[model samples]
Target: MEIDPSEVQSLYRTLAGAVVPRPIAWVSTRSEDGVDNLAPYSFFNVVSVAPPVVMFAPVDGQDGLKDTPANIRETDEFVVNVVTEPLAEAMNQTSATLPHGESEFDHAGLDRAESTTVDAPRVAKTPVAFECSLYEMIDIGASTMVLGEVEWVHVDDSVTTDDKLDVEKIDAVGRLSGSLYATTDDRFSLERPP
Candidate 1:
């Protein structure tokens, strides 16, 4: 059945549900006043490889820009932490909206690790974290698509094999419809048609 987004009563839910599984970018940023913020965005993906750019769309909230996007706008720096099965619950906790000056890292009871190149702190327990600088911010309707250039990457030795990240060693978590989440265990590979 074809459904028009404008006609659907629950277009957000419909599109979110139809998207199957989406990777979560647990983005962390620092406010201009140095207040750290963390939030998870499922509307995220890698945009380029050469310069190593990633994009995450954060929809504007009722009062205006969310803390993450606002902080990025001010500082022009952020960190994208990878969400895994072990940290799924904590990641969800960080999604809560708190006072403007409050920090999700403290709210979620997570430790902060100093980033190599950015002022924003990274999740200490995260298996992988990409320290990025703002590449651009584009307004797409109600959402702001934040593009960041990866300046430094932190990968836990346990999750890597011979200096490369091994997916088999990583138990990444993904977003499903509503409050549901998925694991990468059921993955399958296909060869390129040459």
Candidate 2:
């Protein structure tokens, strides 16, 4: 239980390395050659609200630039599709190391819909989608963290309730270490004092 990361063969598979409740980011991008790339990143979160920004880190692959980073550099646009329980299997399928020009959307048989403000397409089945333009991309050692400024948001009417996103209806999925998965059904709240 007290194993050091340097001593482990890989950090990702270790239970202690990846903290639970990691939010999923189903990123959609288009390569320079016009191939649509879709992949999931758990190292993702919203950084700001007033300006509306999100960040996700893509680890280096055997190749220098992964599809998501490359695509963002080329088009300067991307979509973050919120993953739900219904789309978990399909989302997992897109994580395969397919060829550079291969379309994960097609590979996973997921429907694609155009975004409102960005050139990139969104996953049609996702309960919520954020259309974003690249804000900044920073190289962090072995990985690159991309910051996206949200330009538009698409929410499924079914999941909207009382002017808020109904978490219970969204049934969003989260990532765990290894092949494990999680849901947002387990809930707790703490209210701040006025």
Candidate 3:
């Protein structure tokens, strides 16, 4: 199907607009006014490894920058929580449009644990969490692309295998176009030849 994005009513609802296998970023940020905001961004990925940088884009809000972007700008810190199958529903709950000064952690009934390297708190249920400091933020069209330098990483002992993290054990979830979600249950692997 050859469909132009400009012709579509909403880009996000169209199948061809959002690429599949999009990673889920359960971002946690604290507003300058001391409000904790948590939200999931499917437009997220690891951009670099040498300095351990990750990028997530938060679409522009009608009022301006969203809570997460504004919070990161003010505090210069955030946490990226890995959303596993068990925590999928809780993560979705955080995506709701709640009033200011309200915390999604409490609303979602998720435990908030302190981060070692950043002020932002991590989700206790996530298999992995990356504590990051703001590296850069760029305004791209209708979205704000945020780059974060990972300062500390926390991995659950259960998900670690043979000194490496196991994808199957983590059971991570991914976001698809619309309201669809996917799991890592269907697996395949390939190794490059020497």
Candidate 4:
């Protein structure tokens, strides 16, 4: 079946559903007035690693940019936290829409720790967090892609190995379309052939 981009709203569901197990970026950013906002976006991935850049797309509200993207545009900083099984519920809670200036961390009963390189706080219990400074924002129809350059990284000692992250220990969670979710636990190693 052929679909038209003009009716993005209609085809988005199918597209999102087929993009199985997309990584969750539990993003945290602060508003200009210091209101802390946290939300999860499944449309997130590492776009470049050489200079360490990650991107997440958040669809705009009826008026304009969503709180997270607006805040990032204001503060020029944000933190991307890797969501784990244990924090899944709390991470999901932050996605609820609240009035301007409301704190999702408080709303979700989550703790926050200061970021090393950015003013935005990181999720305290997150196994991995990347403190990023905004590099660019690209608007696509009703959505915007936020590109950030990693300025600093924080990893819980419990989830790290010899200069690498142990995914088994992290047990990161991913979005599987609609209300469904997935875990990294059922993973297999694939060796590259020369």
**lDDT of each model, Cα atoms only?**
0.95, 0.90, 0.90, 0.93
Candidate 1 per-residue C-alpha lDDT over 1-194 given as tens digits, one digit per residue, 9 for 90 to 100 = 88877787657887789897999999999988889899999999999999999999999999888999999999999999999999999999998878889999999999999999999999999999999999999999889999999999999999999999999999999999889999998889999999
Model 4 spans > 4 angstroms off: 1-9
List TM-scores for all candidates, in order.
0.97, 0.92, 0.93, 0.95
Residue-level lDDT tens digits of model 2 in 63-118: 68888888998899999999999999999999998876889999999999998998
What are the runs in model 1 whose C-alpha is more than 4 Å off? none
Candidate with better lDDT, 1 vs 4 = 1
Clashes of each: 0, 0, 0, 0
Scored against the true structure, residue 4 in model 1 reaches a CA lDDT of: 79
lDDT rank order: 1, 4, 2, 3
Ten consecutive residues with minimal summed lDDT in candidate 3? 9-18
Q: Please identify model 2 stretches exceeding 4 Å from their true place.
A: 1-10, 14-18
Per-residue accuracy of model 4 over 1-194 as CA lDDT, tens digit each? 77787866567788899998899999999988989999999999999999999999998999999899999999999999999999999988998989999999999999999999899999999989999999999998779999999999998889878978877778999899889999988888999999
Candidate 4 clashing pairs? none
Ranking by TM-score: 1, 4, 3, 2
Root-mean-square deviation (CA) per prediction: 1.0, 1.9, 1.6, 1.4
